[model samples]
Target: MGRTRDRLKKAIAQSRIPSSHGIRYANELLALGAWFREHAEGVPAFARNRDLYAHVNEEVLGDAPIDLFEFGVREGSTISKWMEVNSNPASRFFGFDSFEGLPESWRGGVGETPAGSFATGGAVPRLDDERVHFVAGLFQETLSAFLTQDYRPTGNRRVLHCDADLYSSTLFVLATMHPWLDPGSVIVFDEFDSPLHEFRAFVDYTSSYRRRFRAIARTGPLLARLAVEILE
Candidate 1:
C-alpha cells in the first residue's frame, strides 16, 4: 500500500497539466462545497448582507450591547450598517483598515482585484457616531498593538466582523484575536464564499488553533456572508 501511494504521488508530481485560475478555483469550490455540506447544511440563510447583520444583531445577539470589531473598513459602509443595527449606547465599534485598500491583489472566481483596490486615500470615514472608531494601518502593524495597549475587556458579548478579503489578512486577524475569542463569541465573514481566501483562512485558523464553531447564519449566493458562534 505504501509503495502504491508513493508511485501515485510520483506520477502526480510529474504530470504536465498546467493549472489555470479557473481550474484552481473550480477545485476550491468543490472542496468548499463539501465542507459546507458537512458544517453549514441547515443554517438560516438571508438574501442580503445587511439583512443578515440585522438578524444577528436582533435575533442572534439580542438587545445587549456588544463590542463589535470590524477588520475591513472599505468605505465604512458595513460598519455603519452594524452600528445602525445595534443601537445600544454601550456598544462600541472599532474598525481597522489601511483605508488604502487591499494590501495585496485579490484573485477571486470573477477576476483579480489589484492591490489598493479599495483605497480611500488613507482617509478614514467621517461617521458622526462617537462610539465608532477607526484604526488606520496594516493589520500586521496595528492589530497586535491595539490588542496589547488599547483593548479593554468587558463583559459584553464580542462580535468580530472579518471583511478583509485576503487569506493573509483574515488569518492574521483570526490568529491574533484567538486569545480573546471566548466561547459564544460571534464572528461574521463578509466574503466567506471566496474559497481560496476567506474560506481557506477560516479552515486553517480553526484547525491550527483547535477551535470549534457552529454556523449560525449565512447570506448571499453560495453562502458569501456567513456568521458563526465559537463553540469552545
Candidate 2:
C-alpha cells in the first residue's frame, strides 16, 4: 500500500496534463471525505452555522465567558451570532480581518473566489456591542502585535472562529495561536468542505502542531461548518 501510494504521488508530480488538476482536487476531496467519516460521522448536524454555534456555546462551552477570536469577519454576521448565542457580559469577542476580502484567489469546489471578493470597501462593520472589537488589517501585519501587547489570557475558555477561507490564512492563524490553544479550545471552521483550502489547513495544522481534536458538531452540506474541541 505504501509503495502504491508513493508511485501514485510520483506519477501525479510528473504529470503535466490539464486534467490532472481536477484529479488532484478529487483526491483531496476523497481524503477529506474519509477524514469526516472517521471524525464526524455521528456528530450533531445543524441546518445553519448559527445553530451549530449555539450548540458549541451552550452544550460544548456551557455558555460560559469565552475569549472568542474570529479570524475572518466579513460583514460581522457570524461574530454577531456568536455574541448573541453566548451572551456572557464577561465574554470578549475580537474580530480580525483585512476587511479587504481574501488575500489571493481561492480555487475550490465552487470555482474561484477572486481576491478581494468579500471586501467591505475597507470599512469595518458597526456593531453596537462594546464587548466586540475589530482589528482592521491583514493577519500577517496585525496578529503578532495583538497577541503580544493586547491579548490577555484569562480563566475564560478560548474559542477560535476560523472563517478565513484560504489555506494560508487558516494555517497561519492556527500556528501562530498555538501557544494559547489549551486542551479544551474550541475551533469552529466556517468552510470545512473546501478540501484544498480550509480542510487542508485543518489537516496540516493538526499534523504539524501535533494537536488533537474531536469533531463535536457540524452543519451545511458535506459538513461545511464544523466545530471541534481540542482534546490534547
Candidate 3:
C-alpha cells in the first residue's frame, strides 16, 4: 500500500492537471477499496465506509462522461465520492494536493489556518473506483496551458475547482481557467469568505469584466464553499 500510494502521489505531482486524469485514477482505486472492505465489510466501526462517494457519483454522473476535479482533495474524500457515482468504464476525476501537507501560509478562514485539519495526514482510504486520480504538489504556476492537456470526452469543457485555502491560489485558478471555460463550465470555491485574499481577489477580478458571476450552488457557512457560473 505504501508503495502504491507513493507512486500515485508521484504521478499526481509530475503530470499536468488534466481534466480526465482524475476520473481515470478513481476507477483504478476501486479494486483496492473492495479488497479492504471484503475483510472488514461487515464491521460496524466501518459504517463510515458506506461508500459516500458511490452515492454522490450515482446522483451526479448518471450516464454522462463528466470531467471532475477537486482543488483541495485532502485525503481524497470528495474524490472518492466522485468515483462512487461516476466511475463507469468511462469517467475521469482529477484531484490536486500539496501532498507533503498544507502550506504554512494557508491562512484564509475566520482567523488562523484550520488547526489539526486539512489533509488527513494518514494513508488515503481505499475505494474501488478507477476514475479518480491525484496530483500532488502546489499549483503555484502562472501559466494555464496545463488546462488544455489530456482532456476527457465531454462538451462541458473544464471544471476547475479552487480550494487552495489561501487567497492567491484561488485567484490564480480563476484567472487561468477564465480563457478555457465555456457556457456550461463551473468553478467551485471552497471558501468564499476567506478573511485572507480569496474573496477580495475573485470579486476584484470578476468586477473588471463586463461578465460577472452568477451563483449556482453554495454548501453554506459564512466562509463556506461556492459554485458560480462565469458569464460569457
Candidate 4:
C-alpha cells in the first residue's frame, strides 16, 4: 500500500506543470510584449554569460577581433571566461560594475534581492592582461565616457553581457549601449526572467529605436540570447 501511495504521488508530481513550461510561457508573453512595442515604437534585442558568448564566438566571431562588454562583474569570473574562449590577439574586454552591488533594489515584487545587494565593497578581481580592462563605478557615471572616449570606437564586433538585476539599471545599460550596437552584435541577458526589469527594458529600448532583432538562442531557462543582423 505504501509503495502504491508513493507511485501515485510521483505520478501526480509528474503530471503537474514543470517550471520550464512557466519559462516558455513567460518567454512567449515577452515575445508578444516585444511585438506590441515594436509595432508601437522599435525594439532591439547572457548566461554565466559564457555559453552565449561561446556561441557567438563560434558562430559569429570566428577570427574577428571583437570587443566584449560585460555589465555586472561581481567576482570577475565571467571576464575570465571571455578571455578563455576568445583568443584573437586584438580582442579587448571591458567589465563594468559598481563592484558594490545592485545600485538599488530590483523592481517591485520581483525577488528578495535588495538595493546595494551583491556589493563587493568596491573590491573587484584583477586581471593582469592588458587585453582586459575594468571600469569601476555606477553605470550612469561610467558608461558614457567608455562609450565615447575610452573605447576604440571602430573595427570590432560588439558582444554585451548584462547581469545587472534592477529594471532601472538594466534599462540604463540598454539605452546607453544601443548607440554602439551594430549589425551582427550579440546581447546576452543573464537574468531575463525578471519580466519587469531586464525584459521590460529590452522591449522598450528596441521599440524606441524601431530596431529589429531575432531570438537566436537561449541558455537554460534564464538567459535570453538575441542577434541584430541585417537581413539580406
Instruction: State in Å the error of residue 94, model 3.
Output: 0.9
Worst 10 residues of 2 by lDDT: 1-10
Query: Which consecutive 10 residues in model 3 have the weakest lDDT in total?
Result: 43-52
lDDT of 4 by residue, 23-120 (tens): 44445445644544443223222343466667667876784887888899998887788888898888988999999888776633212567888888
Report the C-alpha displacement of residue 200, candidate 4, in angstroms.
0.8
Model 4 poorest ten-residue lDDT run: 39-48
| Candidate 1 vs. true structure, TM-score | 0.89
Q: What lDDT would each prediction earn against the true structure?
A: 0.87, 0.88, 0.52, 0.69
What is the alpha-carbon lDDT for the whole of candidate 4? 0.69
Q: What lDDT tens digits, residue by residue, belong to model 3 across residues 158-231?
A: 45566666656666666665666666556656555443355555665676644555554444211244555666
> Tens digit of lDDT per residue, candidate 2, span 44-74?
9999888899989989899999999999999
Off by over 4 Å in 2: 1-17
- Candidate 2 pairs with clashing backbones: none
Using lDDT as the yardstick, the better of models 1 and 3 is 1
**Which pairs in model 4 have colliding backbones?**
42-206, 42-207, 42-210, 43-206, 43-207, 44-206, 46-188, 46-189, 100-119, 105-115
The candidate maximizing TM-score is 2
